[model samples]
Target: MTARRSMIRRAAAVAAAATAAVVLAACGGGNDSSAGHEGHGKSPSPSASAPASASASAKQGEHNAADVSFAKGMIPHHRQAVEMAELAETRAGSAEVKKLAAEIKKAQGPEIKTLSGWLTSWGEAVPTEEESGEHAGHSMSGMMTPEEMDKLQKSSGKAFDTAFLQMMVKHHEGAIEMAKTEQSNGAYRPARDMARAIITSQSAEIERMNKLFGKS
Candidate 1:
C-alpha cells in the first residue's frame, strides 16, 4: 500500500508540471499577439502620411484672380528691375550703389521666374515685355518709362549713381504698394509670402538708400 501511494503521488506531480508548461506557452503566445496588434494600431505608415502632406501643399498652391494678377504684374516689374540693376555694373560710381543693384538683381531675377511659374500653373498667360506693352500707358507703379530708361543708360559716374538711387527708391515703393495689395487681396500662400518679404526687405533698402543719398 505504501509503495502504491508513493507511485500515485509521483504521477500526480508529473501531470501538474505538464499542465503548467502548457498554460505558460499559451500565455506567452497571447502576449506576443497582443503586442503586435498594439504596435500596428499606434502609428501610421510612412507611405500613408506622405500623400497627405503632398495634398496639403497642393491646396496651398491653389490661387485666386487677385493672386494671378499679383504674379502677372510682378513678373515684368521684376524683369525691369533686373534690367536696371544690370546697368549699374557699367554706370554706378559708388561701391554701395553697385552692391545694392546686385542685391536687387539677385533677389528679383529668381522671383521673376517664380512669378512666371505661378502664372503658368494657374493657367494664366505670362506677360512678355512686348505683350506687356498693351498696358504701357497705365504701366505698373514705379516702372521706368522708355525715356527714363534711356536717361539711365546715358548717364555714368555720379550722375548714374544719383539717378539709379532715385529710380530704385521709387521702384521699391511701387513694389511695396503692390505687395500691400497682394497682402490684402491675394489667396496663394507662396505669392503672398513673397509679397510680404518684398515689402520688408525693400523697405529696409529704401531707408538705407535715403540715408546714403542724404534724402529724408
Candidate 2:
C-alpha cells in the first residue's frame, strides 16, 4: 500500500509540472505576438525622419538665380492676374467670362502665397506690392501695367468681356513663356513643378478664351 501511494504522488507531481510548462509556453506565444504588434506601431526613427526633411529643404534651396528671379517675378505677375479677375465680378457681362475670372482669381491667389512662402523659406526676399521696379527691368510676363489695370477697372458689360478676354489671352501667353523658361532653367523641383502646372492650366484657359473671343 505505501509503495502504491508513493507512485501515485509521483504521477501527480509529474502532471503538475507538465501543466505549468504548457501554460508558460502559451503565455510566451501571446507575449511575442504583442511585442511584434508594438514594433509595427512605432513611428520612423529620427535618423530616417531627418534625411527626408533635409532633402526637401535642400531641393528648395538648391535653386539658381533664375529660380529666385522666377519666384520674384511670378508673384507680382500672379497678383496682377488676381487683380484683373476681381474686376470682372463687378464689370463682366457674360456669365462665362465671370466664371473664368473667378477661376483665375481662385487659382492664382493661392499660387501667389505659395511663391511668396517659397521665397521666404529659401532665404530670398518676398516680393512687395510696390516692388514692380525693384527687379531692375526683369519685366514679369503677362503682368498688366497700372494704366491697363485702370482701364480694365473702368470698363463694364460686353465691352468688359471683350477687353478682359483680349487682355487675359495676351497675359496667359506671356505666362506660358515665363513658365517655359522656368521649366528649362529653374533648379528647384517644386518651382519646376509649379511651372508645369502653370503651363498646363493657362494653356487650357487660353484655348477657352480664344473660343469665347471667336463667338463674340
Candidate 3:
C-alpha cells in the first residue's frame, strides 16, 4: 500500500507539470498575438501621416513666376493709387471725389501690404518709394507722367477734381489689366482671388468715375 500511494503521488505530480506547461504555452501565444497586433497598428502611422504633411506643405508653398510678377508689379501700382487718393483728401473739390478717393485708399492700402508681404516671403524685393517714383514716368499702362502728376498736385478745386477723376479712371484701367493677367497666369490661390477682387472693384469704380467726370 505504501508503494502504491507513492506511485500515485508521482503520477499526480507529472500530470500537474504537463498542465502547467500547456498553460504557459497558451499564455505565451496570447502575448505573441497581442504583440503582433500592436506592431501592425504602429506600422501604418508614418505612411498615413506622410501624405497629410506633404499636402499641407504643397499648399503653403504653391506659387509660380506669374504670382511673383503679379505681387511685384501690383505693389508699386497700388502705392501710386494710394498716393493719388491721398492727394484727393485736401485737394478734391467735390464731396463725391473725396468719398471715392477715400474708398480707393482704403482698399489699395491693405493690398499693397499684402503684396509686399508676399514678395518678402518669396525672397523677392519690394519696390521702394524711390523706385516707384523712378518708374512713375515709365510706360506702365496708364501710369501718370511726372508732368501729369505735378499738374494734378498743383491744381485744386474743380481742376483737381477733373484731373483726379480722369487720371484715376485711367489708373484703374491699368490695374484691371494687371489683375486680369494675374488671374490668367497665377498659380497661387490667394493672389488669384485678390486679382479677381481688384478686377471687379476697379471696374465698378471706373464706371462710377466715368459718370462723375463732367460733374467733378
Candidate 4:
C-alpha cells in the first residue's frame, strides 16, 4: 500500500510539471508576439508620417520666381481693369457695354484679391493702389496713361462706350500675354491654373469686343 501511494504521488507531480511547462511556453510566445507587434507599430509611424508631412509642405511652398512675378503683376493689372470697369457704370451708353463692364469688375475684383493673397502667402509685397498707379506708367502692359484715364473719366454715352471697348480689348490682350508667360514659366500650381483661366476668359472677352467693334 505504501509503495502504491508513493507511485501515485510521483505520477501527479509529473503531470503538474508538464502542465507548468506548457503554460510557461505559452506565456513566453505571447510576450514575444506582443513585443513584435509593438516594434512593428513603432517603426512605421514616424517614417510613414514624416514623408507625408514633408511632401505636403513641399507642395504648399512649391513656387518659382515666375509665379511670384505673375501674382505681383496680375494684382495691379486686375485692379486697373476693375477701375476701368467701374468708370463704365457711369459713363457708358450701350447696355451691352455696361453688362460687359459689370462682368469685368465681377471677374477681376476676385482675381485681384486672389493675387494679393498669393503674394501675401509667398511673403511678397502686394501692389498698393499708389504702387499700381506708379507701375501703370512704366512696366505693366495695357495700362492706360493718366491722360487717357482722364478722358474716359470725363467722357460719357457712346463716346465712352467706344473708348471703353477699345481700351478693354487692348487691356485684355496684355493680360493674355502675361497669362501665357505664366503658363510657360510659372511653377506654382494655383498660379499656373489662374494663368490658364485668365487666358481663356480674357481671350473670349477680346473676341467679343472685336465683334462689338464690327457692329459699331
* Winner by TM-score: 3
Q: In model 1, which runs have C-alpha deviations exceeding 4 angstroms?
A: 1-60, 132-137
lDDT of 3 by residue, 1-216 (tens): 999999999999999999999999999999999999898876566778998999998987588999998888888778888999999999999999999999999999999999999989889998888766757448466778888889999999999999999999988899899899999999999999999999999999999999999686
TM-score of 2: 0.70
State the C-alpha lDDT per candidate.
0.87, 0.87, 0.90, 0.88
Residue 61, candidate 2: alpha-carbon lDDT: 51
Q: On a 0 to 100 scale, what is the lDDT of residue 11 in model 2?
A: 100
Q: After superposition, how far is residue 95 of candidate 1 from its true place, in Å?
A: 0.7
- Residue pairs with backbone atoms closer than 3 Å in model 2 (clashes): none
RMSD of 2: 10.4
- Model 2 alpha-carbon miss at residue 186, Å: 0.8
Q: TM-score of every model?
A: 0.70, 0.70, 0.75, 0.74
Candidate 4 wrong stretches, greater than 4 Å:
1-57
Task: Please give the clash total of every predicted structure, in order.
Answer: 0, 0, 0, 0
Query: On residues 1-216, what C-alpha lDDT tens digit does candidate 2 reach at each position?
Result: 999999999999999999999999999999998999889988878897898898888766588888898898888788778878999999999999999999999999999999999899889999778875434224766666777777888899998899899999988988889899999999988899999999999999999999998765
Clashing pairs in 3: none
lDDT (tens digit, per residue) of candidate 1 on 1-216: 999999999999999999999999999999998999998887777987998899998887678888988888888788878888999998898888889899999999999888888888778889978744436416798877878889999999989988988998998898899999999999888889999999999999999998767631
